[model samples]
Target: MAAAGWAPPRLPGFILTERLGTGTYATVYKAYRKTDTREVVAIKCVSKRSLNRASVENLLTEIEILKTIRHPHIVELKDFQWDSDHIYLIMEFCAGGDLSRFIRMRRILPEKVARIFLQQLACALKFLHDHNISHLDLKPQNILLSTPENPQLKLADFGFAQYMSPWDEKHVLRGSPLYMAPEMVCCQQYDARVDLWSVGVILYEALFGRPPFASRSFAELEEKIRSDRAIETDLVVEAVKKDQEGDASAALSLYCKALEYFVPALYYESDARRKEAIRAKVGQYISRAEELKALVTSSSKSLLQQGNPARELLREMAKDKPRLCAALDVASAAIAKEEEGKDDNDTLKLYQHSLGELLLLLAAEPAGRRRELLHAEIQALMARAEYLKDQMKMREAQSMGKEALAEPVRSTCTLQ
Candidate 1:
């Protein structure tokens, strides 16, 4: 249950069909507007009493911000109503789930796919910034994709968003610790750049399959973020250093060095052009890193680190039987190249292989590390699976010549 009121007066022509989601402050339900030809919508119910005067004022401010902006990438707010106990916001429902779930099935999205999604998100952010509105909570869970083929990415859940001049600054910590900018973690005043920092985090996750800073606990995550620590594992450092040593990869090495320098520059300096260039280059590096990391992370080192007996056998087999090892290597390289060239279908295949490999590795690992690794791997695989399923369903509907595709299932609190 959320802090919001559990019940409210039944508004005319609106029939609540199912629960969509529950959050700290509100519960959203899938409902239909019966009077206006039975239009489907998502109604967010918020308790008027649960919110303090300041928070209530903020809600009103959000309403005002929504009313001012009308973009395809921004979710449409249909109506706002309240009785004595609760306030309800009627909005267009996105058939596809949030971005977090989408990312779970696909460990890492390809560069082109991520760029398309980010471009739409960037447009919406730019619109909000132009209006002096800052979406304090900018995470994958708050971003919703409308459908599979026409996956219109829309930003949602603006309850924590605020409006302030670009020049204005306030020292208050807000948003999820994993996505919070370094300055925000330190409780320093930040500008629109804070939102950009969050965008960078999302971009990182899209390419790397995990948040830039991840930890088992919020306290640990906060400390890591506040200290401006990079989540680059030793394997990643070694890979980069190896690349730097190769003359063939010297250009790539320089590009990575420039990107590393740029992250800190945004923290210390306020040069706009330099930041933009850095962001563009960082995006490229993240994409390339995805390909390289996948190869390295799936290699013998990762398996041996988990103490997999099968990996030891596999290694011995490779050394003892050279032809067989070469065949396996060629097969793996071919699959990787195929996935790199593939669009939607290739993405699904890549996820399937990764998921299979992870499960196999997990089964061979000790129990202590197995749980943690399995949880992370499952999250990444599930997100990609959902994305593929959604895409397939949309394609099937189009083949059948349907006027409008059916909506995906909405979240429910319980079986009842």
Candidate 2:
């Protein structure tokens, strides 16, 4: 989806070149000084027409913070100027682009390499911490690498940052749900430690190549963060065994199970370094799971088989419930389509429609074993749908590589 304010503004002193990226309220561009030195820079342009009271305050704060902070690891806000139409933040340019693209290009970073980058991030955070500032939106997208070779991490994007002390607390959703701390996400009072939680998530993604709680929606992400770990250790152990035994399907399932706990663990852990270690593991496991999911096209279907038994149990339990039976029938057709190796997208849609009907019924059911069985069946259906989604992504990625069928994330997507 296009963001709110995505227009590029004409600046008198600089020549705006290609677009960089956009956020909810600002669009950044790559520009060069028109003077003798001709230094390259990034200009963040915010359209005045799009700013409300809250966004204006955020823009002001971002300017105030970046202009004042001069740490080597933090992005330098070289200067700022405003016109009748828009607000422009001219800042130092990082050649290698944001960390998200950096990691995507390499697939995953080595632990040693990730450690160096993490240390740079920690240094920048420590500076912020000592100065009583909290960067609430510390995701991979906000971290930039100076150059692809000998890359140096530079922290940027301070629109959600606040000058909260270690003890000061506030209750508001301040950042993206995928990387948000549980306290902030759950709407509890959160302090500077919230940044630490984000730090862990970033570190985890650096290791695993994706966030631990990445989901199709905010609801699913919240559930993963709130749910218990169910002996996450046991899950990782089994995953390790399965991976060694060449069961990619089982291994992928177990790794996802392990990740469901890792997010909550990140919340409660106090020691910073220990949290980083746990987060590192989450990333590696997630990366492996994603890799396994891609290859699931050729791997065994143990998880699919397990989800099948639940489908049978649901059909038996729905003997007296006509609507429930009908939903089960739809689910059966979805399974049939999958077994025939037809269009996975069509099968996924059928499962989604059936699950929608079953979930409403499941919600009203009294506390009993039948309700439990229905819930299990829903989860099974969801697992199948998720597998199909992953299969589609794998195919999409391969096709893009072979035929250049899609736009790269870093290239032009903004409306300006």
Candidate 3:
């Protein structure tokens, strides 16, 4: 939420509860969907007059890009409306406020906290960049948190966003000067890599409470930005090296950085062999990170569950049935290990939802080894679910038994 101290505006279908903030061209409000009270959303209201040609084009681009994307770290655009006077964009509400406000309130986040947000941001950026979308304005203010304590950050405010291919050249200069990449300031043609530079700046600021470059004047800022060799990943590189020297925690910490760097490298690399080499490195790092995290956290169960990279690769390859089976195998193992004995309602509900998802995927998969695997996995999950239900019922009966036994003694005590 950017600082908008304006009066709350009204929309027909939404009940605006609080004014979130205002941007240059729009005001945002926390609103409830009238038809579905449980649905909370942020409605960005912009007057038609506020949009010039460029602004209108930007709005369209944002809508186009957002409509196609579905990632946890990216803010979901639920719906939009164009009225006679204004356009309203309904988005998922971030209860924790924007990253800028969070930083100002807390000064600086701890390393682990910063890493979680940064990792998620990197993932969001990877997804966007993969789809040829560039979120040019990558700053704390444009990043929103799902909650203050939980802190699931969502990328927001895509007004300066652009869709550029590897060969395309972008001459326009936009975004906050403080966080702008050197290439952006130099008027050089840039691609998704510029977003990566902004990620570095944000990460630095999160750790140190200030951006990498601080200048008194715009001219000085531009000079500093252009002169800086590259966004410093020295800290990350050092962490990785330390991890190789046998630091489990450091290894866990550097996992996302490895992933972050790997994404852009893999996406930009034209040579197939080189890309595969990078993929192997990323896979090894991630697998090691999971192992190290498990070692660091001494729990009965593994702290980090394994995700099937093979399945993900297959999905990317569009090998549908094989991907489905891979997904089912992963989920089945996790469920069997984690929820076999748990009878809690919430846990059961979650397992049921997961099984339902697998069922849907299974339906789409063609008949073969993949379909057979899905069927077997689904049956196993169903059996586990029933066993859990039986456990719950037994507990309930035991509780009732105790209550019944106590009733006779209570009556005798009252008579006495």
List the global CA lDDT of all models: 0.66, 0.80, 0.72
Estimate the lDDT of model 2: 0.80
Q: Write the per-residue lDDT of candidate 2 for residues 147-168, one digit (tens) a residue.
A: 8799899999999899998999
* Cα RMSD, each candidate: 17.0, 20.0, 23.1
Q: Compute each candidate's TM-score over C-alphas.
A: 0.57, 0.58, 0.54
Candidate with the larger TM-score of 2 and 3 = 2
State residue 373's C-alpha deviation in candidate 2, in Å: 63
Model 3 C-alpha lDDT per residue in residues 269-342, reported as the tens digit of each score: 44445545655555555566567656655531342233333444434443545545565555555465554544
Clash tally, candidates in order: 10, 1, 0
Clashing pairs in 1: 104-380, 104-382, 104-383, 105-381, 105-382, 105-383, 105-384, 105-385, 106-383, 106-384
Q: Name the regions of candidate 3 deviating beyond 4 angstroms.
A: 1-5, 36-38, 227-416
lDDT of 1 by residue, 1-416 (tens): 22345443476668876677887777788788878588888888887778887778778887888777789999999888888878898888998878888888887777788999999999999998888888988999999989856588999988778887799786777788788887787777787679998998998788667886888887777677655333453334554676666532333333344444344433433444444444444455555644443454355234323432343344453465454344334434434544454565655665565566555555655555434545454454455455344444434423322211122222233214
Candidate 3, which ten residues in sequence have the lowest lDDT sum? 404-413
